[model samples]
Target: MNNEILPHEEVINDTLNHFSGKFENIFHQDNYDHYRSAIHDTLDLVGTFLHRNDKPFSGIEAKTMKKMVQHIDLNQKLSSYEEVLKEVDEIYVQHATAFHLPQYVAHLNCPIVIPALAGEILVSAINSSQDTYDQSAGGTFMERKLIDWTAERLGYTTESDGVFTAGGSQSNLMGLVMMRDVFSQKNLNHNIKQDGLPPEASRFRIFISDKAHFSNSKNASIMGLGEKSIVKVPTDNEFRMDITMLQKYMKREILLGNIPIGIIATAGTTDFGNVDPLEDIANIAAQHNIWMHVDAAYGCALLLSAKYRHLLNGIEKADSVTIDYHKSFFQPISSSAFIVKNKRELRILKHHADYLNPAEMDEEEIPAQINKSIIQSTRRFDALKLWFTLRMMGQEQLAEYTDRIIDLTKDVAEMITENQEFELLTHTDLSVLVFRYLRSDIEDLNALNLHVKMKLFYSGEILVASTKVDGQFYLKFTFLNPITTTEDVHQILNTIKKHGEDFGTTN
Candidate 1:
């Protein structure tokens, strides 16, 4: 087969030029054939490369990788679209993490479904900005509908409202920002948004579980609350937050004249996947008139799992909540939202911009999404991915997939516990297990575990994550991929043992 372009390529180029420039034709359907051909060819190459290299990941040395990247110059131009696609295939496609692979039991990444994949293509093609109604049209309504649906599932009040955000981190920032402003207004008659934080801002505090995601402290810092403002409540043996300890800390802070502004209850912590006791935490926050926020980024999948929904029993009581569909709902990254129990609370983040959402539009009886969200002036249409997935496959099917992964986690934990060389750190709370290898005659087990993890990572045969627990390194298995089977688990276990034994023998 000839590799050159068609003999009629010049005619096609002339016709394309007659319409407009390349950028202008992209938005018009008249040039869809040209666009479709390029997309089809690119995706075909990606699929073929992935099929050939089924391993989850591979690592290249820093020096070698840097040299390879330096070889590509921005000023250099490729001859044809085929050459561009081939270059991309070699540089990125072969090395990108294959979350679909069963051996890739690493982070909270999920294997995306077909419907969402299709939605992703449509989203990129249309390039809708969901920040305002005029910019996104139906996309604005679609996002709000998904948020309302999610609120209903969590059993929140009918007055609840939410906005799609980049991820859990930004959502957490929004929740805390609201808490800070609202607390200032209610207690000190201060508007932080207008007059800025009070001199006593340093005295304001937010209570959170010891196992909560690091975003709490980071958001506190970003909001000018300072890192010292975060008070981590102790966790029980199961890693769930201790309700009594939280109450004690809150009371002590109050006695010291520090106003407790918010309480963050984590539903599925990053490393352990353990959930805080939401009911108890909610009651404590109510007693103190504090804003209650639940970080359910990892555990939100339980809301869809009919059999496991009770795991997040008191999540609805939260004044605000953060849920990452990307993490738990098996959607692609950048799919998440921050929800509030009362729609009026969203006013704290609202601003009127004449160029975007003007006051005149509100006076003329118009609605725009920019009035709600705290971030993103030009946001991508991500809600379409979830909407299409739910409409095509149904929530029930997704729930079934979630339950399967949870069950797989439990089985894998048992296998690790039964092994003599392996030490299971904590019980399966959601779908994460942090464990390390501990051979009877081995010394410096931490170093051994680290070496084993890096060895497997460099080998590119399988991929998994590692974390530190109580100052010791342990491997982590986050079973978000439903395709990861018992056999895959056994193979990974065998690989870990082999690596550990070899390291011990060599070192």
Candidate 2:
């Protein structure tokens, strides 16, 4: 100390203390009480909203947001935390839904369980970065094991690999990247990363079911293979992809000399929850030498339940797949995975950085998991929630939870079938059921259904979504809450019926 030289340990200790002090309020242990209470209250609210059990909105809150919110510019820092948080509190007061409420039944979004919430707290506190072994240490191994657990659920025998991502969109993007990797011949012969793809391999094409998530087509365009390059195959009456149409299109496209690079098939379509005929599509992909990627973000939850697992036959045959634990598994906002059968094919992401470890001539064994992930550095350890869900609940328990929603949705569908006021758009094979409010008095029934949906959302006693199916408007009931029941569905129906009967908008 007398020498007036700063010691390295002293500096590190001081720096750590400084950061702990500066970020004290940002993430505090004391906030857990407040945070946990918030989660509980919000979950209750969501439960009410989804099953159409909440009080109708009177536009008071919307007016509040409009009047109170100061236009926020991304570059500007908050003038005061309290000032901003007040607005936020109001926003939540208005927008937050009781998704866990037994009556909540609109969106595919699930009411998250407490165990997963606890995992979220633990993971966020640890802040483990999964970019490298050194970054996450044991967390990397934990995430990989979680991936293995999910792959097992899908019936993958031996060789399977995957990486957890932020959400389904990111997972879908990763799938496209993988297809690009293998098709482009990025690393088979030499260091293709060091040099770009050969000119001949640069041009690419992708295919997706017409009913597939827009993310599939958007991802294709974002990957430099323009949107027009993605061919949309037709689907038959059941809403599953028509294999014959796919074959016809592929043959014609091939005849014109367009290479079939990838095929993206959806397991559960967003509007109808229809599972595509995977076996037929799988056979066609194999025949055409195309990469098969299944976007099973919504229906992937069915794999755990034997009753619903048959809906996704030939899933194991998919070269790549995207699954969203958030959608049906009741995980928090972000938790998705993109997986492939061939472990070695993950080499596409491998590239040596100047700061990265150089391969030692003597070192024989290295784990492929390090370089397999689509993101290069700074990956979040999102697997903890899934791991907790699977290990704690077990697959059977999870399956039973999913089955509960399926049963409730079917009940709601049957009710719709019985009521003249409600017209069934299609029978639900999974959780989501599409229908419309069709009172016999209405001449233009489709327009009335659309009006019912808009009025329902504005009224807010229930929040139901709508979709255009086969050139007509249909209101959607995406039942994902396990605790929901027939009583809940009837409550929503009653609300809709009351609205349908009302002739005046002056409520």
Candidate 3:
């Protein structure tokens, strides 16, 4: 050693050797008494540091990260395990999203309940994939049963099946792919999954609401149906899709000899939380004999709410529906389900390679789940969180959680309405409110509101998301945390008012 400059491999090897060993070979406490104090202090310090928020609202911005990591490696020869743990923890864990905090009411999916988090740990430990029975035996069985349970909730027949996906975007993509497989009958007759896209892929057109999620257009583009192929149906004042307009457009397109592929009805839109009149839309879909899909990612959790379940009326008639556990069901992110009214729609994505999910003539149980699913393989058993949450809290508790956030949204709407400086975006349909900061005689404050949002984000006191509606910037609060109270809304309003006054005076 040249007076002690350590190589990279030597250091890494030393660290690994200290951390792992054979269980029986490592249990000699008397031999390791010298290292005992280090472990206790390290564990205690880690737990203690977790309680501290590196920045306000418990979210770590870049500035906060740089401030936390002020020192550079000029050359400290040897550091204790506790010191190294502290440094690594500060760098890595400090910049995490603060879902546990009461103020985190920003995006579609934020916090998850503790039960689901516990399930996350358990599922991670087991690490099951949803590809086959042997790959995730218990997970596979549970997911199938979960599908049946979800089907029952949706009022579908016993033949219905669903799978948990990464998120709403993937679920919607899968739905569109299924429709692609279905409408191309010549390809279906010849078996497309084994074959490929039919030659007539260019003619297929997807009809979606004007207020559909961006993911719809994205999915269309991904599935080889160009974004231009999605015909936008005008929405009514309530933001619900105009079924009459949709029918009119379909008729015009049909007369023009356009191939109608599938109809997508949004159950909950991003802007105003508007759900299309599914009952009316369903009738139009049935009359036209088009495949109907419902993107109910944010609003499908209404199924759990006794009072609000009526909002999703006729959802059962949909050919497929996308439900996000991460958004409304209060599970962690990457929890969503694409449920098909008919189980046969799932067969479109099945692929069989030799070592993967090979098919045999005499094989019982159909030989493969790969055939009846959209995803390729190696799915993180994410549905276990839903299953665990359901079993632990039950539907009633979940409903209560949803109801609490809804009540909070109501409080925010009321506060925004009474405030002279603030304008209410829309009435609270679900647990989301879109509002803007404007005094009397507001013309166009889109750019101003955009700046205000950026300023607020940089300040890191209160958290809210900015959305553009009708070409105007509006601040939105999507309350997912049950613990978020009326007081929290009051805090956000106070901040907005203060910012408005300061901004006006400065301007």
Candidate 4:
């Protein structure tokens, strides 16, 4: 080759050296000080943002935000940490929705506990993959302990076992998976894991309340069953699953030569926060030899509540249960679990990977969390968040927060009922209120309510949600923050009233 190095070769060498130097930021022991400094700076920024944020939203329009984001050039050279942080603050933190605010009574989102946030820091820094014991070591056992604790709270026996999931949707999917496989194996002698769904899968049906989460229909579709596989039982006046209607549906479906595979009961429905008749549904499921799954994603907080725990009375009878710690438990996003009454049910999801978790490892008594999981391979250490919350705050304190929210909902419902301009739809069993602004002079009530919601969102003073009930639009308030007082509700209602009046006067 040439005695002198070529220009392109020199350029390549320079680039290689630069890339190698970047390894200093790879979070090794040698970069501990650098890591600590960066984390401290980031935390300080976040703390300041939280303290300064006054509104739930910045009221920035979608087109405006999109244009702001589009102006940034991702292909540009790397900038200093300070420059990057400044841009992030302007684009994200400034306009971010403040779920922690008392005015942000819109969705199922909750203001997370401090301990869980601390746990999240450790989880991201350590980056323990909860797939196999060798990958996570002590984290594996720690997660299992939390699962056991949750199972106990759910009144599940020692034989019960579960795995952490992303959220309610994934947890609900796992429950349906178990229901599908167990029914297939027992009735059709088909191993869904090995041979795929049986021919009779089309005939299989799941029963859910009309007000149940949309995940039931989605999960059925995901499992090779059509959307028609889900039969929505009508709800009563209180928006709870009517037990008689459910029984009638089951009999009718069977009469039509369709097999009732499972019942997915909602504990704390999304809009009304009303729980289905769990005990009655459990009895029906047992009588029919069908699986019973409780999607307690929202109301699982009742597991710890001393006063409202009875609302989840027959949850113990469920073959599987889904719990979202992120919702009522006040944990961060993507913290949820799917538990089964029998540990043996998890065997259906087991598989062997020679380089990862081989079959021989099981014989050697190695604990691998992948054995119980279906969709996930490399999973986050989300269980630690719940573990920290329980250890630092204790279950009693958490339950008190739950009780406060439930009590608060009742107070707000009464307030809405007293307001002549407002119409209360249903008295919730949990912390959700559904109501609508009413005006006899307004010919289009739906259009008026919709306009009010949009105006409030654009005004940025308050953040509330809206949903359609029986083809009529209604405003929804989901109280997850214990700090949100009756005064906050009063202010929120006044804002809505003001908007409604503005619409009436303008239109």
**Per-model TM-score versus the true fold:** 0.94, 0.85, 0.84, 0.95
* lDDT tens per residue, model 2, 158-254: 6998888778887888888777667667324533455654454434567777888888778776766778778899988878788889888888777
- lDDT per residue (tens digit) for residues 378-466 in model 1: 99899999999999999999999989989999999999989888999898668999999887777888899999999989888888899
Query: For model 4, what is the error of residue 490's alpha carbon versus the real structure, in angstroms, after optimal superposition?
Result: 1.0
Clashing pairs in 1: none
Residue 94: error of model 3 in Å? Answer: 2.4
Clashing pairs in 4: none
Candidate 2: residue 266 lDDT (0-100): 91
> Native-vs-model 2 lDDT?
0.75
Local accuracy of candidate 3 as per-residue lDDT tens digits, 1-507: 468967999987776666554332243443355355665676676466558753334445778678777765748644566567667766875555566566666777656777898788767656777777677777877877887887888889987988888888888998888777777753346455666666666667788888898888888887667887788999876777887898888888878777787899987787777688889888887876778999999988788889788888999999999988888888887888889998866666666666767756333553444555565577888889988999999999998887887777787788789986888867757877788888554355775677667667767666678787777788888787887788877877787767765654555
Q: Give the top-scoring candidate (TM-score).
A: 4
lDDT comparison, 1 vs 2, better candidate? 1
Q: In model 4, which regions exceed 4 Å deviation? A: 1-20
Q: Runs in model 1 with CA error above 4 Å?
A: 1-25, 363-365
Candidate 2, position 370, lDDT: 47
Which regions of candidate 3 deviate over 4 angstroms? 1-50, 54-85, 186-191, 361-368, 441-444, 504-507
Clashes of 2: 14
Give per-residue CA lDDT, model 4, range 66-125, as digits (tens).
Answer: 998999999995556677778889899889999999999899999999999999999999
Best by lDDT: 4
Better of 3 and 4 by TM-score: 4
The candidate 2 region of ten consecutive residues with least summed lDDT is: 361-370
